[model samples]
Target: MKKWREYERLVSALTAEEYDKEYTVIPNARIKGFISQRKRQLDVLVEYRFNSDLNRRIIFDAKDRKRPVDIKEVEAFEGLMKDVGARRGFLICSNGYTKSALRRAQEHIVIKLLSSDQIDDISIGSWDMCRSDSCGDGLIMWDLTPGIIIDGTVYIQATGKCDSCGKFHIWCWSCGNRICIDYESELQCSCKGPWFWLTSIEPDCDEIGEQYESHYLILVLGNGNYHIMDRRPI
Candidate 1:
Protein backbone atom coordinates (compact mmCIF):
# COMPACT_ATOMS: atom_id res chain seq x y z
CA MET A 1 0.00 0.00 0.00
CA LYS A 2 2.79 2.39 0.84
CA LYS A 3 4.43 1.66 -2.49
CA TRP A 4 1.18 2.40 -4.34
CA ARG A 5 0.85 5.73 -2.57
CA GLU A 6 4.42 6.50 -3.53
CA TYR A 7 3.65 5.69 -7.14
CA GLU A 8 0.57 7.94 -7.08
CA ARG A 9 2.61 10.75 -5.59
CA LEU A 10 5.29 10.32 -8.21
CA VAL A 11 2.74 10.30 -10.99
CA SER A 12 1.18 13.47 -9.62
CA ALA A 13 4.47 15.33 -9.86
CA LEU A 14 4.79 15.23 -13.64
CA THR A 15 3.38 18.27 -15.46
CA ALA A 16 0.69 18.06 -18.15
CA GLU A 17 3.21 18.99 -20.84
CA GLU A 18 5.66 16.40 -19.60
CA TYR A 19 2.87 13.81 -19.52
CA ASP A 20 1.71 14.59 -23.06
CA LYS A 21 5.22 14.50 -24.44
CA GLU A 22 6.30 11.36 -22.62
CA TYR A 23 3.06 9.74 -21.44
CA THR A 24 4.44 9.98 -17.93
CA VAL A 25 1.87 12.08 -16.07
CA ILE A 26 -1.23 14.24 -16.16
CA PRO A 27 -1.54 17.87 -14.97
CA ASN A 28 -3.62 20.05 -12.62
CA ALA A 29 -4.32 17.17 -10.30
CA ARG A 30 -5.77 17.13 -6.79
CA ILE A 31 -6.77 14.57 -4.20
CA LYS A 32 -10.51 14.62 -3.47
CA GLY A 33 -12.04 14.83 -0.05
CA PHE A 34 -14.12 11.99 1.37
CA ILE A 35 -17.25 11.60 -0.77
CA SER A 36 -20.43 11.62 1.30
CA GLN A 37 -22.99 9.09 0.08
CA ARG A 38 -26.17 8.88 2.13
CA LYS A 39 -24.31 8.64 5.45
CA ARG A 40 -21.09 6.94 4.34
CA GLN A 41 -17.73 8.27 3.19
CA LEU A 42 -15.86 6.69 0.27
CA ASP A 43 -12.18 5.70 0.24
CA VAL A 44 -10.57 8.21 -2.11
CA LEU A 45 -11.63 10.68 -4.77
CA VAL A 46 -9.17 11.91 -7.42
CA GLU A 47 -9.53 14.34 -10.32
CA TYR A 48 -7.15 15.32 -13.14
CA ARG A 49 -6.98 17.47 -16.25
CA PHE A 50 -5.83 15.56 -19.34
CA ASN A 51 -3.42 17.21 -21.75
CA SER A 52 -5.62 17.05 -24.81
CA ASP A 53 -6.60 19.69 -27.37
CA LEU A 54 -10.25 19.20 -26.37
CA ASN A 55 -9.43 19.79 -22.68
CA ARG A 56 -10.55 16.35 -21.63
CA ARG A 57 -11.14 15.76 -17.92
CA ILE A 58 -11.50 12.66 -15.74
CA ILE A 59 -12.34 11.60 -12.21
CA PHE A 60 -11.68 8.39 -10.33
CA ASP A 61 -12.36 6.47 -7.14
CA ALA A 62 -9.26 4.70 -5.93
CA LYS A 63 -8.92 1.94 -3.36
CA ASP A 64 -5.55 0.60 -2.19
CA ARG A 65 -6.78 -2.77 -1.03
CA LYS A 66 -6.25 -6.30 -2.31
CA ARG A 67 -9.93 -6.90 -3.07
CA PRO A 68 -11.44 -6.77 -6.53
CA VAL A 69 -13.32 -3.65 -7.64
CA ASP A 70 -17.10 -4.10 -7.43
CA ILE A 71 -20.24 -2.83 -9.18
CA LYS A 72 -21.35 -0.61 -6.29
CA GLU A 73 -17.94 1.04 -6.28
CA VAL A 74 -18.27 1.91 -9.94
CA GLU A 75 -21.75 3.31 -9.37
CA ALA A 76 -20.47 5.56 -6.62
CA PHE A 77 -17.73 6.87 -8.88
CA GLU A 78 -20.26 7.51 -11.62
CA GLY A 79 -22.34 9.58 -9.22
CA LEU A 80 -19.27 11.57 -8.24
CA MET A 81 -18.31 12.23 -11.85
CA LYS A 82 -21.74 13.66 -12.59
CA ASP A 83 -21.53 15.92 -9.59
CA VAL A 84 -18.17 17.19 -10.78
CA GLY A 85 -18.74 17.67 -14.51
CA ALA A 86 -16.27 15.08 -15.73
CA ARG A 87 -16.19 13.58 -19.23
CA ARG A 88 -14.73 10.23 -18.14
CA GLY A 89 -14.26 8.22 -14.97
CA PHE A 90 -12.21 5.32 -13.60
CA LEU A 91 -12.03 2.87 -10.74
CA ILE A 92 -8.44 2.12 -9.68
CA CYS A 93 -7.97 -0.83 -7.41
CA SER A 94 -4.92 -2.51 -5.93
CA ASN A 95 -5.83 -6.12 -6.65
CA GLY A 96 -7.32 -5.46 -10.14
CA TYR A 97 -10.96 -5.58 -11.25
CA THR A 98 -13.33 -8.52 -11.34
CA LYS A 99 -14.78 -9.76 -14.64
CA SER A 100 -18.32 -8.72 -13.72
CA ALA A 101 -17.05 -5.44 -12.31
CA LEU A 102 -15.05 -4.73 -15.45
CA ARG A 103 -18.08 -5.43 -17.62
CA ARG A 104 -20.16 -3.07 -15.53
CA ALA A 105 -17.50 -0.36 -15.64
CA GLN A 106 -17.36 -0.67 -19.42
CA GLU A 107 -21.07 0.12 -19.41
CA HIS A 108 -20.39 3.47 -17.69
CA ILE A 109 -16.72 4.60 -17.73
CA VAL A 110 -13.16 3.64 -18.64
CA ILE A 111 -11.70 1.36 -16.00
CA LYS A 112 -8.01 0.83 -15.20
CA LEU A 113 -6.89 -2.15 -13.21
CA LEU A 114 -3.38 -2.36 -11.75
CA SER A 115 -1.64 -5.31 -10.20
CA SER A 116 0.72 -5.13 -7.26
CA ASP A 117 3.60 -6.15 -9.50
CA GLN A 118 2.92 -3.30 -11.92
CA ILE A 119 2.83 -0.83 -9.04
CA ASP A 120 6.29 -2.01 -8.01
CA ASP A 121 7.91 -1.21 -11.37
CA ILE A 122 7.18 2.53 -11.50
CA SER A 123 10.01 4.96 -10.63
CA ILE A 124 9.58 7.11 -7.51
CA GLY A 125 12.18 9.78 -8.24
CA SER A 126 9.74 12.04 -10.06
CA TRP A 127 7.88 12.85 -6.83
CA ASP A 128 10.97 13.90 -4.89
CA MET A 129 11.86 16.42 -7.62
CA CYS A 130 8.46 18.15 -7.81
CA ARG A 131 7.47 18.74 -4.20
CA SER A 132 5.54 21.94 -3.49
CA ASP A 133 7.53 24.58 -1.56
CA SER A 134 4.87 26.84 -0.14
CA CYS A 135 2.07 26.45 2.38
CA GLY A 136 -0.57 28.97 3.39
CA ASP A 137 -2.19 29.22 6.83
CA GLY A 138 -5.96 28.83 6.71
CA LEU A 139 -8.74 26.26 6.88
CA ILE A 140 -9.36 26.01 3.17
CA MET A 141 -12.68 24.50 2.10
CA TRP A 142 -12.48 23.61 -1.57
CA ASP A 143 -15.77 22.72 -3.19
CA LEU A 144 -14.62 19.39 -4.66
CA THR A 145 -17.63 19.92 -6.87
CA PRO A 146 -15.65 22.34 -9.06
CA GLY A 147 -12.05 21.06 -8.90
CA ILE A 148 -10.19 18.74 -11.33
CA ILE A 149 -7.59 16.00 -11.10
CA ILE A 150 -4.62 15.44 -13.43
CA ASP A 151 -2.58 12.30 -12.73
CA GLY A 152 0.50 13.51 -14.65
CA THR A 153 -0.64 11.88 -17.90
CA VAL A 154 -4.36 12.56 -18.30
CA TYR A 155 -7.20 14.69 -17.02
CA ILE A 156 -9.09 12.67 -14.42
CA GLN A 157 -12.15 14.94 -14.66
CA ALA A 158 -13.47 18.49 -14.85
CA THR A 159 -16.25 20.04 -12.72
CA GLY A 160 -18.50 22.72 -14.18
CA LYS A 161 -21.94 23.60 -15.64
CA CYS A 162 -23.46 21.88 -18.66
CA ASP A 163 -23.43 23.83 -21.93
CA SER A 164 -26.98 23.03 -23.06
CA CYS A 165 -29.30 22.84 -20.05
CA GLY A 166 -27.02 25.16 -18.12
CA LYS A 167 -27.09 22.59 -15.31
CA PHE A 168 -24.21 20.60 -13.82
CA HIS A 169 -24.07 16.98 -15.04
CA ILE A 170 -21.58 14.16 -14.82
CA TRP A 171 -21.16 12.30 -18.15
CA CYS A 172 -20.14 8.67 -17.78
CA TRP A 173 -19.91 6.81 -21.09
CA SER A 174 -19.48 3.50 -19.38
CA CYS A 175 -22.57 3.25 -17.13
CA GLY A 176 -25.01 4.76 -19.61
CA ASN A 177 -26.26 7.06 -16.85
CA ARG A 178 -26.21 10.85 -16.79
CA ILE A 179 -26.17 12.37 -13.28
CA CYS A 180 -28.09 15.55 -12.61
CA ILE A 181 -26.68 18.16 -10.20
CA ASP A 182 -28.36 18.90 -6.88
CA TYR A 183 -26.76 21.80 -5.05
CA GLU A 184 -28.84 21.68 -1.89
CA SER A 185 -27.81 18.13 -1.23
CA GLU A 186 -24.65 16.54 -2.56
CA LEU A 187 -26.80 13.81 -4.13
CA GLN A 188 -26.88 14.29 -7.92
CA CYS A 189 -30.37 12.93 -8.44
CA SER A 190 -33.06 12.08 -5.92
CA CYS A 191 -35.77 10.84 -8.27
CA LYS A 192 -37.10 7.45 -7.21
CA GLY A 193 -37.61 6.21 -10.76
CA PRO A 194 -34.84 3.95 -12.03
CA TRP A 195 -34.09 5.62 -15.36
CA PHE A 196 -35.36 9.00 -14.33
CA TRP A 197 -32.31 9.57 -12.20
CA LEU A 198 -30.02 8.18 -14.90
CA THR A 199 -31.06 10.16 -17.96
CA SER A 200 -28.97 12.94 -19.63
CA ILE A 201 -29.49 15.99 -21.80
CA GLU A 202 -28.38 16.42 -25.43
CA PRO A 203 -24.65 16.17 -26.09
CA ASP A 204 -22.62 19.27 -26.92
CA CYS A 205 -19.99 17.90 -29.31
CA ASP A 206 -22.25 17.24 -32.31
CA GLU A 207 -25.32 18.56 -34.10
CA ILE A 208 -28.53 18.18 -32.05
CA GLY A 209 -30.72 16.77 -34.87
CA GLU A 210 -28.10 14.31 -36.08
CA GLN A 211 -27.09 10.97 -34.63
CA TYR A 212 -26.59 10.86 -30.84
CA GLU A 213 -23.22 9.78 -29.56
CA SER A 214 -22.51 6.96 -27.10
CA HIS A 215 -22.17 9.06 -23.96
CA TYR A 216 -24.25 9.37 -20.78
CA LEU A 217 -25.90 12.72 -20.02
CA ILE A 218 -26.83 13.57 -16.40
CA LEU A 219 -29.63 15.85 -15.26
CA VAL A 220 -29.33 17.15 -11.67
CA LEU A 221 -32.40 18.21 -9.73
CA GLY A 222 -33.11 19.10 -6.11
CA ASN A 223 -34.90 21.70 -3.93
CA GLY A 224 -36.94 22.95 -6.87
CA ASN A 225 -33.79 23.92 -8.85
CA TYR A 226 -32.56 22.18 -12.03
CA HIS A 227 -29.41 21.94 -14.19
CA ILE A 228 -27.67 19.71 -16.78
CA MET A 229 -24.17 18.57 -17.67
CA ASP A 230 -23.31 17.27 -21.15
CA ARG A 231 -20.46 14.76 -21.13
CA ARG A 232 -20.11 14.01 -24.86
CA PRO A 233 -17.87 15.84 -27.34
CA ILE A 234 -20.30 15.49 -30.31
Candidate 2:
Protein backbone atom coordinates (compact mmCIF):
# COMPACT_ATOMS: atom_id res chain seq x y z
CA MET A 1 0.00 0.00 0.00
CA LYS A 2 2.88 2.35 0.68
CA LYS A 3 4.25 1.83 -2.80
CA TRP A 4 0.79 2.36 -4.25
CA ARG A 5 0.46 5.54 -2.24
CA GLU A 6 3.73 6.78 -3.70
CA TYR A 7 2.55 6.04 -7.20
CA GLU A 8 -0.74 7.83 -6.58
CA ARG A 9 1.14 10.80 -5.19
CA LEU A 10 3.21 11.00 -8.34
CA VAL A 11 0.10 10.92 -10.52
CA SER A 12 -1.60 13.57 -8.39
CA ALA A 13 1.40 15.86 -8.59
CA LEU A 14 1.64 15.55 -12.35
CA THR A 15 -2.10 16.06 -12.74
CA ALA A 16 -2.14 19.17 -10.54
CA GLU A 17 0.74 20.64 -12.50
CA GLU A 18 -1.06 20.10 -15.79
CA TYR A 19 -4.67 20.99 -14.93
CA ASP A 20 -4.77 23.16 -11.82
CA LYS A 21 -5.30 26.40 -13.73
CA GLU A 22 -8.22 25.46 -15.96
CA TYR A 23 -9.65 22.59 -13.93
CA THR A 24 -9.93 21.75 -10.27
CA VAL A 25 -7.83 18.69 -9.62
CA ILE A 26 -8.54 17.22 -6.22
CA PRO A 27 -6.33 14.45 -4.88
CA ASN A 28 -7.85 11.88 -2.52
CA ALA A 29 -11.30 13.25 -3.11
CA ARG A 30 -14.28 11.86 -1.26
CA ILE A 31 -17.57 12.38 -3.04
CA LYS A 32 -21.09 11.16 -2.44
CA GLY A 33 -22.49 8.62 -4.86
CA PHE A 34 -25.64 9.75 -6.58
CA ILE A 35 -26.99 6.23 -6.92
CA SER A 36 -26.15 4.71 -3.55
CA GLN A 37 -26.17 8.00 -1.71
CA ARG A 38 -23.01 6.93 0.04
CA LYS A 39 -19.59 8.48 0.25
CA ARG A 40 -17.12 7.08 -2.24
CA GLN A 41 -13.41 7.66 -1.99
CA LEU A 42 -11.78 8.63 -5.25
CA ASP A 43 -8.10 8.80 -6.02
CA VAL A 44 -8.60 12.10 -7.79
CA LEU A 45 -11.58 14.08 -8.97
CA VAL A 46 -11.31 16.77 -11.65
CA GLU A 47 -14.16 19.26 -11.87
CA TYR A 48 -14.82 22.06 -14.33
CA ARG A 49 -17.59 24.10 -15.81
CA PHE A 50 -18.43 23.26 -19.41
CA ASN A 51 -20.72 26.27 -19.62
CA SER A 52 -22.87 28.54 -17.54
CA ASP A 53 -25.35 25.79 -16.76
CA LEU A 54 -23.32 22.60 -17.11
CA ASN A 55 -20.68 21.17 -14.82
CA ARG A 56 -18.35 18.44 -15.99
CA ARG A 57 -16.80 15.97 -13.59
CA ILE A 58 -13.98 13.55 -14.34
CA ILE A 59 -12.42 10.87 -12.17
CA PHE A 60 -8.97 9.31 -12.04
CA ASP A 61 -7.96 5.98 -10.53
CA ALA A 62 -4.44 4.68 -10.08
CA LYS A 63 -3.57 0.97 -10.16
CA ASP A 64 -0.11 -0.26 -9.23
CA ARG A 65 -0.12 -3.97 -9.89
CA LYS A 66 2.66 -6.18 -11.17
CA ARG A 67 0.63 -7.62 -14.02
CA PRO A 68 -1.36 -5.78 -16.60
CA VAL A 69 -4.88 -4.68 -15.62
CA ASP A 70 -7.56 -6.92 -17.02
CA ILE A 71 -11.09 -6.52 -18.28
CA LYS A 72 -12.64 -7.19 -14.90
CA GLU A 73 -10.80 -4.30 -13.34
CA VAL A 74 -11.86 -2.01 -16.14
CA GLU A 75 -15.46 -3.09 -15.73
CA ALA A 76 -15.38 -2.44 -12.01
CA PHE A 77 -14.01 1.02 -12.57
CA GLU A 78 -16.70 1.67 -15.15
CA GLY A 79 -19.32 0.91 -12.52
CA LEU A 80 -17.73 3.45 -10.22
CA MET A 81 -17.82 6.06 -12.97
CA LYS A 82 -21.54 5.49 -13.40
CA ASP A 83 -22.20 5.61 -9.69
CA VAL A 84 -20.48 8.97 -9.41
CA GLY A 85 -22.04 10.31 -12.62
CA ALA A 86 -18.63 11.25 -13.94
CA ARG A 87 -18.50 12.48 -17.50
CA ARG A 88 -15.27 10.55 -18.07
CA GLY A 89 -12.69 8.46 -16.26
CA PHE A 90 -8.97 7.91 -16.55
CA LEU A 91 -7.38 4.75 -15.25
CA ILE A 92 -3.64 5.16 -14.69
CA CYS A 93 -1.75 1.94 -14.23
CA SER A 94 1.90 1.41 -13.48
CA ASN A 95 2.22 -1.94 -15.28
CA GLY A 96 0.10 -1.16 -18.33
CA TYR A 97 -3.10 -2.98 -19.36
CA THR A 98 -4.10 -6.31 -20.80
CA LYS A 99 -5.50 -6.55 -24.30
CA SER A 100 -8.91 -7.40 -22.92
CA ALA A 101 -8.79 -4.40 -20.66
CA LEU A 102 -7.87 -2.15 -23.55
CA ARG A 103 -10.78 -3.47 -25.58
CA ARG A 104 -13.19 -3.01 -22.70
CA ALA A 105 -11.98 0.52 -22.12
CA GLN A 106 -12.45 1.21 -25.81
CA GLU A 107 -16.00 -0.09 -25.61
CA HIS A 108 -16.78 2.51 -22.96
CA ILE A 109 -16.45 6.02 -24.34
CA VAL A 110 -15.85 7.43 -20.89
CA ILE A 111 -12.96 5.19 -19.99
CA LYS A 112 -9.37 5.97 -20.92
CA LEU A 113 -6.35 3.92 -20.00
CA LEU A 114 -2.91 5.33 -19.47
CA SER A 115 0.46 4.05 -18.43
CA SER A 116 2.48 5.77 -15.75
CA ASP A 117 4.87 6.88 -18.47
CA GLN A 118 2.30 9.35 -19.64
CA ILE A 119 2.84 11.47 -16.54
CA ASP A 120 6.06 13.43 -16.43
CA ASP A 121 8.10 14.59 -13.49
CA ILE A 122 6.47 17.38 -11.56
CA SER A 123 7.46 19.51 -8.56
CA ILE A 124 4.58 19.77 -6.11
CA GLY A 125 4.90 23.03 -4.21
CA SER A 126 2.64 25.14 -2.06
CA TRP A 127 0.51 27.40 -4.22
CA ASP A 128 -1.65 29.60 -1.97
CA MET A 129 -1.39 31.25 1.42
CA CYS A 130 -3.69 30.27 4.26
CA ARG A 131 -6.40 32.89 4.75
CA SER A 132 -5.98 32.72 8.52
CA ASP A 133 -4.92 36.16 9.72
CA SER A 134 -3.28 34.83 12.85
CA CYS A 135 -1.54 32.01 11.01
CA GLY A 136 0.69 34.34 9.03
CA ASP A 137 2.31 32.92 5.92
CA GLY A 138 0.65 29.54 6.45
CA LEU A 139 0.47 27.70 3.16
CA ILE A 140 -2.90 26.34 2.02
CA MET A 141 -2.94 23.16 -0.02
CA TRP A 142 -5.76 23.82 -2.44
CA ASP A 143 -8.15 21.26 -3.82
CA LEU A 144 -10.25 23.71 -5.76
CA THR A 145 -13.37 22.70 -7.64
CA PRO A 146 -16.37 24.39 -9.17
CA GLY A 147 -18.34 26.42 -6.66
CA ILE A 148 -21.34 28.77 -6.79
CA ILE A 149 -22.06 30.84 -9.86
CA ILE A 150 -22.39 34.58 -9.40
CA ASP A 151 -23.69 36.90 -12.10
CA GLY A 152 -22.96 34.73 -15.10
CA THR A 153 -19.57 33.72 -13.75
CA VAL A 154 -18.56 30.45 -12.18
CA TYR A 155 -16.37 30.74 -9.09
CA ILE A 156 -13.81 28.12 -8.13
CA GLN A 157 -13.39 27.64 -4.38
CA ALA A 158 -11.24 25.60 -2.02
CA THR A 159 -11.15 25.08 1.74
CA GLY A 160 -8.04 23.59 3.19
CA LYS A 161 -7.09 22.90 6.75
CA CYS A 162 -4.43 25.34 7.85
CA ASP A 163 -1.21 23.65 8.74
CA SER A 164 -0.30 26.29 11.28
CA CYS A 165 -3.54 26.72 13.17
CA GLY A 166 -5.59 23.66 12.12
CA LYS A 167 -8.34 26.02 11.01
CA PHE A 168 -10.35 25.98 7.81
CA HIS A 169 -8.86 28.33 5.18
CA ILE A 170 -11.22 29.33 2.37
CA TRP A 171 -10.22 30.80 -0.95
CA CYS A 172 -11.41 31.81 -4.38
CA TRP A 173 -9.32 30.42 -7.18
CA SER A 174 -10.43 32.79 -9.93
CA CYS A 175 -9.56 36.06 -8.17
CA GLY A 176 -6.94 35.27 -5.52
CA ASN A 177 -9.40 35.98 -2.72
CA ARG A 178 -8.82 34.27 0.61
CA ILE A 179 -10.55 34.04 3.98
CA CYS A 180 -10.19 31.97 7.11
CA ILE A 181 -13.36 30.73 8.74
CA ASP A 182 -11.65 30.65 12.12
CA TYR A 183 -11.28 34.41 12.25
CA GLU A 184 -13.93 35.38 9.72
CA SER A 185 -16.94 33.42 8.44
CA GLU A 186 -17.84 35.77 5.62
CA LEU A 187 -16.80 35.29 1.96
CA GLN A 188 -16.57 37.91 -0.79
CA CYS A 189 -15.39 37.72 -4.38
CA SER A 190 -12.63 39.80 -5.89
CA CYS A 191 -15.25 41.98 -7.60
CA LYS A 192 -16.05 43.39 -4.14
CA GLY A 193 -19.38 41.58 -4.22
CA PRO A 194 -20.48 40.51 -0.76
CA TRP A 195 -21.36 36.81 -0.30
CA PHE A 196 -23.88 35.88 2.38
CA TRP A 197 -23.47 32.65 4.28
CA LEU A 198 -26.51 30.46 4.95
CA THR A 199 -26.80 27.00 6.41
CA SER A 200 -29.33 24.13 6.12
CA ILE A 201 -29.42 20.92 8.07
CA GLU A 202 -30.53 17.63 6.56
CA PRO A 203 -30.79 14.24 8.20
CA ASP A 204 -29.26 11.25 6.47
CA CYS A 205 -28.23 7.67 7.15
CA ASP A 206 -25.04 5.95 6.02
CA GLU A 207 -24.69 2.58 4.32
CA ILE A 208 -24.79 0.94 7.73
CA GLY A 209 -27.87 2.93 8.69
CA GLU A 210 -25.89 5.25 10.90
CA GLN A 211 -27.04 8.84 10.82
CA TYR A 212 -24.72 11.50 9.46
CA GLU A 213 -24.64 15.02 8.10
CA SER A 214 -24.70 15.99 4.44
CA HIS A 215 -23.27 19.35 3.53
CA TYR A 216 -23.63 21.41 0.34
CA LEU A 217 -22.95 25.03 -0.58
CA ILE A 218 -25.46 26.75 -2.79
CA LEU A 219 -24.59 30.07 -4.35
CA VAL A 220 -27.13 32.46 -5.82
CA LEU A 221 -26.47 35.84 -7.38
CA GLY A 222 -29.01 38.63 -7.34
CA ASN A 223 -29.11 42.39 -6.86
CA GLY A 224 -25.34 42.63 -7.29
CA ASN A 225 -24.69 40.38 -4.31
CA TYR A 226 -23.98 36.67 -3.88
CA HIS A 227 -25.60 34.33 -1.37
CA ILE A 228 -23.94 31.11 -0.28
CA MET A 229 -25.94 28.47 1.55
CA ASP A 230 -24.70 25.29 3.15
CA ARG A 231 -26.83 22.16 3.63
CA ARG A 232 -25.44 20.11 6.50
CA PRO A 233 -27.16 16.90 7.52
CA ILE A 234 -27.39 16.10 11.19
Candidate maximizing lDDT? 2
Compared to the true structure, candidate 2 yields what TM-score?
Answer: 0.55
Ten contiguous residues minimizing lDDT sum, candidate 1: 135-144
What would the per-residue lDDT of candidate 2 be over residues 113-168, giving only the tens digit for each residue? 44555534433355456665677644444555456676677666665544334344
How many clashes in candidate 2? 2
Q: What C-alpha lDDT do the candidate models reach, one value each?
A: 0.38, 0.57
- State each candidate's clash count: 39, 2
Model 1 residue runs over 4 Å out of place are: 10-55, 129-234
Cα lDDT of candidate 2 equals: 0.57
Tell me each candidate's TM-score. Answer: 0.41, 0.55
lDDT score, candidate 1, position 79: 76
Q: For model 1, how does the per-residue alpha-carbon lDDT over 1-234 read when each residue is reduced to its tens digit?
A: 255445343333322223232121222223222233222222222322211112244544556666878878777777776544455665666776777777777655876665567656755442211111232211111111322222333222223322112233443332433444442224432323222223333323322222222223333333333333223222
